[model samples]
Target: MSMRVAVVTGAARGIGLAVAQRLASVGMKVVMADLRDAAQAASMVNRDLCAGVDADVSDEASVQQLVAGVVARYGRLDVLVNNAGISPKHGGRKARVEDTALPEWQSVLDINLTGTFLMCRAALPHMRAAGWGRIVNLSSQAGRSRSAVTGAHYAASKAGILGFSRILAEEVGGDGITVNCVAPGRIATAMAAAVPETVNQEIAARIPLARLGTAAEVADAVSFLVSEQAAYLTGVTLDVNGGYFMA
Candidate 1:
């Protein structure tokens, strides 16, 4: 059998890189996709299983080409980890709704929410044709509640992702595809660096784990959802927040 092909967006660094590395290590043909820096990531990952693409997930044209190029090269796509996202600009968080600019809010939703939507829509044709697929979205704890530091737009986008994943799962379960999400909390990444250190440290002290979550930890959760072991699971949001929020 041919190796399974997987694409993970925003995989140039941090959680995205960790997930891409893990998937590649497991013998999957991992395409590490990102817009900010693609050549750097392609050069860094293991040569055998990882490849990189400078893809802007927010743009439909870019996403179309991204999926097509990957499929053209590998012949199939089995797993998709939508890890590309932003805080305020991409809806991970936003300032006060009234104060936030419409363009900024739209930009956030475009990248964080619309980006995921487009990837899923584009990948579905191939997945449905093959009769098997795995989609793992990177949501956030803020989606469940309010962000301690992130903006409202970020929270709203993530919340939207949760509902979208559930519905997609229900729609495709009969076709041998699973749609799931991972909601991370306080992971130590450049994205999280936006907040002040003093605030970050204070927030870290509140988690039951009493420490920041690692990118690798979140990757593990994502890997699980996309693997055959999770065959029976779908439409669920697995929280990887170090007990920041229960239930």
Candidate 2:
């Protein structure tokens, strides 16, 4: 049997990169997709088991080309980790809803929400044809509850992912495809480092872990969701928030 092919978007760094490395380490042929430095990142993961592709998930054409290229090279796409997202900040602070710019709002939705839609749409047929697939969309704690650290647009896009994953899971379950979400809170990634250190410390003080979560920890949750052990699970949101939020 051929090795399973997994594509991870925004994989040049942070949680996406960690997930790619984890999947590759498990013997899957991993494709790390990002707008920049993807090839370099993939090389760092495993030169023989990983390949990188530059893609703009928000652009329909780019997404189509990305899937086509993956299919051409691997003959199948078994898993997709939609981790590409942007949380714009000003002076390391979230913009107030009333002060948020329209363009910023649109950009967040386009990348965080629409990008996931495009990647899933392009990859579903291939997955259904194979009769097996795993899709893990990255969500945020802000989406699950009120957050002072993230803007409204970021929260909306993430919350939209939860709803989208549920509906898609229902539509594709009969086809052996499982769609789920991982809502991470205050992960110690470059994205999280955008804010002041004191801000993270304050948030950590409120968490049961008393520290920020690691990217690899989040990757571990994703690894399970995409594995056979999780076959019976679908349309569920797994929280990796270190007891910061419970629902």
Candidate 3:
């Protein structure tokens, strides 16, 4: 088969960038979309199959442009990775839900949950036409339960992704498209580092692996689902938590 074309949201940095880079490494053409400029990220990562486009996953029109831009260049969409998400301004950033602003809560839902929906909805037509597609949503351990470090909105949005993926998986399975989610545990990143050293140590100590996960590790899980290996694995939430929370 020819190299697959994929759109990875929030690909400017951190986990999103890692996922985009991983896919590109595997002969996939990746369109790196982010709320911020992706030029720097594109320059830093593998360039052969990677391109950057500024996009706000939270906006309907922006998402439309994103899909159109990719299909315009790549001709088809083989994968959609919904990795663009925001920590609730008040909560996930070390504040409690009660302390969070209304905008923060709504923004979290808009990007984390609604953003995923928009991307999937916009990409569905293209996938149905091709009769093959892979939709991977970036969920988190918070989705499974309230994380000590995450706010209510962040947890709620991630959890919403799980339910959304399951329903969409069933809706599109017959069309040769698979929908799934990957919930990552604490990874060695700026966001994860926000937790105090004490907190980090405590969480890591509790994990069977006794360490935090790497972005590449999360990428590996996503890579599998988008590959032929996971054709039958739809509507599943693969935990890349490294024994942090096993369910």
Candidate 4:
């Protein structure tokens, strides 16, 4: 059997980078996609097993070109990790809904929600042809529940991902493609670091785990969902929130 090929978006750093590293470690040829610094990051992950491609997930042409380049080089694409998203803050704090500009809202939706849609659309054909695939879209605790730390646009975009994954999962299960989501909460990443330290400390006090979750922890969940062991699972939202929220 040929080596499996995986594409991980927003893989230049943080949770995305961690997931890319994990996948490459498992022997899959990984394509680390990001708007910038992706090649450098992929080199750090595994020069022999990983390649980085520049792509704007929100742009349809860019997405098509990205997947085309991957298939051209690797001959197949078996896994897609849609981890590209943005949670913008204002003056180090979440902007209230009333304060959020139209552009900001559209930007969040374009990247977080629409980007996932575009990537899946472009990759589904390859997966169907191969008769196997795994797709894991990154959601957030803000999407699962109320969040004071994130803006409304962020919450909406993340929630949209959950809905989108569920429908896609149902549609593609017959094709041997499993689509699912990983909703992380209070993860200690650069995104979370945008807030005040005291804010994070207060959040930690409320969680059962008593601390923020790590990027690797979230990556672990993603790794499982994309593995053969999880073949029977589809349309599920695996929460990696450290008991912060239960549904």
Q: For model 1, what is the alpha-carbon lDDT of residue 202?
A: 90
TM-score of each: 0.96, 0.99, 0.96, 0.99
Report how far off residue 153 is in candidate 4 (Å). 0.5
> Number of backbone collisions per candidate, in order?
8, 0, 0, 0
In terms of lDDT, model 1 sits at 0.89
Q: List ranges where model 3 is wrong by over 4 Å.
A: 89-93
Predicted candidate 4 versus true structure: per-residue lDDT over 1-247, tens digit per residue: 8899999999999999999999988889999999999999999999999998889999999999999999998889999999999999988899998899999999999999999999999999999999999999999999999999999999999999999999999999999999999999999999999999999999999999999999999999999999989999999999998899999
Predictions in order: lDDT = 0.89, 0.97, 0.89, 0.96
Model 2, span 39-148: residue lDDT tens: 99998889999999999999999999999999999899999999999999999999999999999999999999999999999999999999999999999999999999
> Candidate 4: which pairs clash?
none
How many clashing pairs does model 1 include?
Answer: 8
Cα lDDT for residue 70, candidate 4: 94
Residue 148 error for model 3, in Å? 1.1
Q: Report clash pairs, candidate 3.
A: none
Best by lDDT: 2
In angstroms, the error of model 3 at 142 is 0.4
lDDT string, candidate 3, 127-178, tens digits: 9999999999999999997588888888999999999999999999999999
**In model 2, how large is the Cα lDDT of residue 239?**
96
